[model samples]
Target: MSALQLQSAAGLLLLPALAWALGGFRRGVAPRVIATALALQLGLAAALLNIPPLRAAFALIGDGVNALATATKAGTALVFGYLGGAPLPFEEPFPGASFILFFQALPLVLVVGALSAVLYHWGVLPAIVRGMARLLRALLGLGGATGFGVAANVFVGMVEAPLMIRAWLARLTRSELFVVMTAGLATISGNTLVVYALVIAPVVPDAAGQLLTASLVSAPAAILAALLMIPPAPGEAATEGEEGIPTGLYDSSMDALVRGTQDGLGLLLGIMASLIVFVAIVALVNLALEPLTGLTLQKVMGWALWPVAWAMGVPAAEAATVGASLGVKMVVNEFVSYLDLARSGGAGLSDRSRLILTYALCGFTNLGSVGIMVGGMTAMCPERRHDIVRLGLPALVSGTIACCMTGAVVGVLTPP
Candidate 1:
């Protein structure tokens, strides 16, 4: 690798440590635990990045993204076929066949939701959460309840994840609340994975699985980072509750599948609406900015976030472009950013740059999300609005850093 690449790698590796420093790890028990976590994460990043087989696995993840896109497109086309619109001709059979993938992609959310329900019913998810909770408790000194909630965020939605520990919400300390918020920001619901994969699959081709894994991996990273930001008090543990998943009103597998399909449709509509308004707003902003500074959001991002992109180990020449992508992710939504990444049609970014972008845009930490999280969490725990408000920015910062860490780790392991 070039010197710049090496520097980028080093910067990416240090992001978690930097996040802790910025988030207030300079004093108390937090300092030691955060330091150790950073060290362990760095070591793990190095080891994983250097292994040949692991590198290949990540690359395969990229390919999986492409396959997922194809699947989503195909599903989309099937759904639209009934809408009676003329088929758009395509140069290749795959592209034409892939139309249904878009519609089918939404189903993934419901699939995950239903699967979560069943897992919860069968106690599988709880067991996994308990195991992860134990690790976080031992390593980061987080309360068991907080650790379980954080781990649960990986499989479920932000609002829903906390409900698993609903009984404890009223009693959680400030630091524990921060962990919950940060974890929510850092992880995406399993239900939305297919949709996000569909968005970026065209650009990165086969990145769906990788993006999914990135979100899952970032869950732990977010938890660790959040704990570093505000270590648990001297004698705190997450309040414990009876462990079991709620059995939704479904009698059979077919019934669950049917309900899941309907839920997926609703989610798909929400995503589409969100994307429409968000993109339109960005366009409006670009138009407004075009006259004053002769710089659009895209250009501004290129200039401002290039260093961050470089720090995450994107090639120097591509750093600005990747930075622009990161900026969009932070300022807007990951969905918008992923669409831009895929359709930018600027000179194509390097494979590594693409991979890094995939990781960076894998979270739900934009300004819009702050409202969603705060509103949703507050609604669940009406008594903790003040705590939620205070913890919001820190959660955003830690969540963003966790994503950046994932990008860096992926970049290090990615073959040049």
Candidate 2:
């Protein structure tokens, strides 16, 4: 095997081993379960990425996503004028110099989010989720409700996905609950994926396809990580719930549009606020420490996570860069990390490193998401609130590991 492939192979083992060591119930971790999960993830990755026909279909989907992203400009320009990418009354200082992230890039989330809600209202998304859920249940040996939750997460937000199986939340075993939480942290919703794709498209070819597959493959990875960290006991299974998304999620297509728009607006505002505050906080910290240590926060984080990036097949010279991005994703959020990656245009990294990081960072595995996941699931089943809280951190860790596992798989499959 090639050197890079060998490194990626090692990462595949190293990540799961880390999960096993951190397992809450080590004795319950079954070898057969781990092997099956890993095999499922690898098989899916091979089919989605390595198979020619499937790859072509996904590439077409990626092109459609890019086109959809472009369609948002019409609305943005109408709302925000020249600042949102409309023709400037005055000429720019240079070509492509007039870009404004707030007005131009972030608004895409709002459009995509609303469209996703409309799709759900039309039952299109639920149909897709339902089919995928059955497939996952058969492949991963998951209960009906657990499988639906995992599948729903791929198309909807973390909180919304659980609503589909809300009836069964109180009855889920500890392991099942952990798996559900991990799946949320491990995958990105459809609306946000568009924004990430927009930021990453400049650096990564077929950014949309990569993001879509990363979310799809990461669902199984989440299950794998959860099983390793907290395996279910014999005869302990998830309670079956209603098999599909609840009909009352939206009153109608119009209601879906309005509600989705409001939700998207809230998300856009939150992201804006987060970026503003987190960037300033990092700057302040950097200012306080730079003179004493001659290193910034990113560099320190890079140093801390250097081994992880290197293990994922990143080159020695570029591992720190990849590590810094991973650190940002964990410390703050994936949005900030993708912004950083886009700003740098994936410079100082190989194609392999960029691909790996793209997959690695395609998750909601930040500290902030722990609270979100815990609160969302707790709200669904008030009786299980304590269990949700206890499992939150482990879910975060397991979910992060799952994302890295997906990256390692991509690295192994990627030609050097």
Candidate 3:
């Protein structure tokens, strides 16, 4: 990367620290800790990117993007009966080729949901949660319940994570609540990984794995940022209790399969609906803005986010374009942004710029998500409704910063 790109990436990497400092963590020690963590993470990302062996290691996640695309193509072909109808000379390789990808990717959500129940029943999830909580407790000095809740987010959906700690949500401190909200906004659910992969794999090399890593890396950054924003208050922390999974929910493995398939169908429908409506709204807005501003809403977003994109290490010429995608993610949704990124054909973006954008746009930071998190969490813990309302804006800011941190890391690691 150029010196300017490096500086920009550094600035973005430090943005979470800046947000934390500005939001609350003004004490001498707090600033130092935040700065040190930021530095360490940046250095780690740089080392991983520059060290040939480490990059090779990351590359070994088995090209999830290619697998996803192949599956999607196969699924599409199967559904449309295009396999045999097309002018291909040979028979369709996979009889239900199109169905295979959809089955592999979309069904993952149901499988995760059901497997999560099984894991919970078997105490597997709690064990993982406890391990993650230990790290959070030592690093951020968070309460056991809050730390576990945040850690649970790594594997589960935003709404599902809180269920593990549902017993304590009503009693959680404000700071703890904020941490939960921020974590939800910062990370993507594993169930949606295939969906997002299918959306951007055409544009992003290794889209599934890279986006998956982005979500995973953003989880810790989100927690760290939230802690800095609202340092844990001095008080007795919530304790971990018996949070076992429901064992009798499914009759057998086949039962689980049937239930999972049904659930996946609902989720797929919802995703399709949301994407259609959201994109249509953006189109309508752009139509209105075009005549007034002499440019489309997209161009305006690109212009507005250009500086931040540059700071995330996108090449200067492609900064606006990438920034526009970020703006779409924040203003609309990550799905919409991913679709646009995949279809843009690398306009105004270099290979490195595209990679950075991939990381940057890999979160649930849009306006729609704020309502979803607040509504979902509030429903799970009605007593905490007020707290959810109060922390909504900060959660949004913290989440965005967390994703930007990931982008910065990717930027520094990617060679210009």
- After superposition, the stretches of candidate 3 with alpha carbons farther than 4 Å from their true spots are 21-36, 43-60, 63-127, 234-252
lDDT of 2 by residue, 28-56 (tens): 65577678877877788889887899879
lDDT of 1 at 88: 59
Candidate closer to the true structure by TM-score (higher is better), 2 or 3: 2
Task: Judge candidate 1 against the unseen true structure and give its global Cα lDDT, from 0 to 1.
Answer: 0.70
Per-residue lDDT of model 3, residues 1-416, tens digit only: 67756765676656765776767654323555566556655665666556787667655543554454455456444654544122345566774343333334454455445554555555576687778777767665567778777777876667777876788888787777888888888888766766777666567765666766787677667876777787665654544442442236567666765675576566666666666777789889988988887887778878987777877877677778887888889877887777677667667778877888788787788777787778788898888888888888889888888888788877766667
Per-model RMSD to reference: 4.0, 1.8, 4.6
Q: Against the true structure, whose TM-score is highest?
A: 2
Candidate 3 clashes between residue pairs 3 or more apart in a chain or in different chains: 8-311, 74-97, 74-98, 75-98, 75-99, 120-245
- Model 1 scores worst on lDDT over the 10 consecutive residues at 82-91
Q: Highest lDDT, which number?
A: 2
Which stretches of model 2 miss by more than 4 angstroms?
A: 242-244
**TM-score rank, highest first?**
2, 1, 3
Scored against the true structure, residue 231 in model 2 reaches a CA lDDT of 83
